[model samples]
Target: MDALLFMIFAAIAVICGINLVVQTHPISSALSLVGVMGALAALYLLLGGEFIAAAQLVVYAGAIMVLFVFVIMLLNAGTEKKLAIRPWGKYLGAPLLLLFFGMMAYVVQRILPESSPVVFGAFQGGTAAEIGRSLFTVYLLPFEVTSVLILIAILGAIVLARKEVD
Candidate 1:
């Protein structure tokens, strides 16, 4: 049952990701992204990451997607215009991507031959409190740096939006 559920959600995530890339309209792309996020949340649940799953659903699928849709609508984004592809991209893209994937697969297989199967309860992504503890303790510097970067970005936006006096 767990394997079946994993397969289902994994397929859903892959399909939604393809849909997201293929959709031409901004709204349609955003909806496809939401579907992808939902599938990822289900995958996290299957991996026994209840907190991460809930966070994925609430923070990504709910809040971020809502913000994306709102911005798209406010901007009245239209269907994406077809762009001309570079010559090399058109001719060599598929073969290069395939080669990269094959190389990565070979390297990973060589490095982790004894990797175990992902079974439920095999790994816990920790509870909210434990995550919070690590976020503030072990990862404090990176967290503070990210907050400062966000503050700088906000300040930059405010400065850019200010009107100049005549």
Candidate 2:
């Protein structure tokens, strides 16, 4: 059951990634990225990383993607102009992608354990309570700093994007 869910989510992520790259419109690409993030969150859930999956969905898929769409809309980005495909890219692209994918599979299979530690329900520390405790105790400063940095970045984006009333 877990394996089947993993495959389904993984396939969704790959398809969304491809769609993100191939889309001409900025909004369409951003939507594809949201799909990718959702698939990744599902995969994280299947791996028993409940907190991580929630964070991925809430942080990446929700907040960050909303920010991206806002930026795209603020900039009024339009559909991308299509360029001529190069012969080499047209001819060798699929072959090269397949070769690299095969190599990655071989290396990952060799490096990883037969029974992966991150399998569903194998990890014990992925609950929200444990992560919250750790964040408050050991990682509090960095977490706070990251939050502040994000706030500043958001402010900077807003300031930069505002139109001057000339």
Candidate 3:
């Protein structure tokens, strides 16, 4: 059951990732990214990383994707212009991508233990309290730096908008 569920979500994640890369429109790509993130959250849940799953849903799928959509809209980013690809690129891209994917799958299968099952209650210690404690104690500086970087991004967006108005 666990393996089946993992396979389903993993397939969803892979499809969404491919969609994200292949989509021409920014909005479409962003939506595909959200799907990828949601699938990853489910995978994390199956792995018993509850806090990490919640964080993935709330932070990446929710807030970060919202921010991305906002930026895309604010900048009026339209569908990407179609550019002519080289003949070899057009002919070989899909085959090369599939070959790379096959190689990666083979490597991952070789690296991971076959008998290790992801049971729901098999792992622990990913609670919000523990995460908060670790973030505040050990990762405080990095967290603060991230906040400052976000502030800068927001400010930069505002400045750009103001310039466009002027």
Candidate 4:
């Protein structure tokens, strides 16, 4: 079951990643990004990281995607086809991509821990009590900061969507 879920998410991640690179349409690219985020959330769920999975869904798929959609709508981004990359840009692109890959590889190698400790506990109830206890006990500062950041984001989005005063 785990293997199957892993394969499913792996495939989705790869496809969405490729779409992210190759799709020319901005809205389509954003949609593909949502797919990638959703697949990652599913992988988190399979790994027993339920809170992380929910956060991924709520933060990435819910708020971020809606923000992207709103921006696209506000800008009318998909109304016209974007111009193709120029030949000179294409000439410099391949090596840039290779350099980016190399840099990411180096960073991952440098940052990844040799061994990750396994966390054992159940905290999946969607009520305030379960979440509040976990947040206060384990992830107090980050949880509070994340809540504040989300509140700020909501305010910002509302401000952006408001009618302009003449």
Candidate 5:
């Protein structure tokens, strides 16, 4: 059951990732990215990384994607121009991509063939309390640095907007 669920979500993620790359319009690519993030969140849930899964949904899929869509809208981004592809590229690109994917799969299978299957209750320590404790304790410096980086980004955006107005 767990393997089946993992496979389903993994497939969804892969398809969405491809769609994100292949879509011509920015909005379509953004939507595809959201689908990929959501599928990844489900896969994280299957792996029992509950906190990480929730963060992925809330931060990446929700807030980040909303911000992306807002920027795309504000910038009035249009669909990408279609470029003429070489006949050789049209024939070879997909086959090369598939070959690369197959090689990666084979490498992963060889490396982790005996790995244990993920079960929901098999792992623990993903609770909010534990995560908070770890974040404040072991990961405090990195957390603080990230907060500062975000603050700087916000300030930079404000400055840029002000300059545009002036």
Candidate 6:
């Protein structure tokens, strides 16, 4: 089951990455990126990281993707031939893509250190109660600060979309 889930996530990640390169439309690329993020969240859930999964979904898929789509729509970009790449872009694109993949492989190989997973006994209740308690108690200040930052981001988005008054 874990292997199947991992395979599915790997496939989605590849598709999202290819779309990032080949999709000329900004909105489509943004949506594809969100798909990648959602796949990552699912993977986190499969690894018993429910809190991280929920955070990924809420912060990336819900809030960030909505902001991206909103900005794309606001720009009123069209899918015209003008969106096509220049002649030189075609000549340089394949090599650039190859270089990017090679660099990514090198970075992954170099930076990812091996670590054994820690096994622990199951709790009496579950993670939700523990996470909630910590969020309101030990991590209360940082959590409240994050909420404030999110609020500011929401207000900034609204102001950016509004028409300016003389």
Kindly list the per-residue Cα lDDT of model 1 for residues 37-154, writing each as its tens digit.
Answer: 9999988877778789999999999998998999899999999899898999999998999999899999999999997777877777566877888899999999999999989998
Residue pairs clashing in model 5 are: none
Question: Model 4, range 58-140, lDDT digits (tens) per residue?
Answer: 99899989988888988887535767889988899899989999999999888985756323233245445666787898999
lDDT values, one for every candidate? 0.89, 0.90, 0.91, 0.82, 0.92, 0.80
How high is the lDDT of residue 43 in model 4? 78
Candidate 3 lDDT tens digits, 40-66: 999998887889999899999999899
| Ordering by TM-score | 1, 5, 2, 3, 4, 6
Clashing pairs in 2: none
Off by over 4 Å in 1: 161-166
Residue by residue across 1-166, what tens digits does model 5's lDDT show?
Answer: 8888888989999999989989999999999999999999988887678999999999999999999999999999998899999999999999999999999999999999898777876777886788999999999999999999999999998998778563
Q: Give the Cα-based TM-score of candidate 1 against the true structure.
A: 0.84
In candidate 4, how many Å is residue 44 off?
0.8
In order of appearance, the predictions have TM-scores of: 0.84, 0.79, 0.76, 0.65, 0.83, 0.65
Model 6 clash pairs? none
Candidate 6: what lDDT? 0.80
Runs in model 5 with CA error above 4 Å? Answer: 85-107
CA RMSD of each candidate after superposition: 2.7, 3.1, 3.1, 4.6, 2.7, 4.5
Error of 3 at 159 (Å): 2.8
- Across 1-166, the per-residue lDDT of candidate 2 in tens digits comes to 8778888988999999999999999999999999999999998877778999999999999999998999899999999888888999999998999999999999988888486444677777889999999999999999999999999998987887696746
Query: Pairs clashing in candidate 1?
Result: none
Question: By summed lDDT, which 10 consecutive residues of candidate 1 come out lowest?
Answer: 157-166
Q: RMSD of model 6, in Å?
A: 4.5
- How many angstroms is residue 148 displaced in model 3 relative to the true structure, after the best TM-score fit? 2.9
* Residue pairs whose backbone atoms clash in candidate 3: none
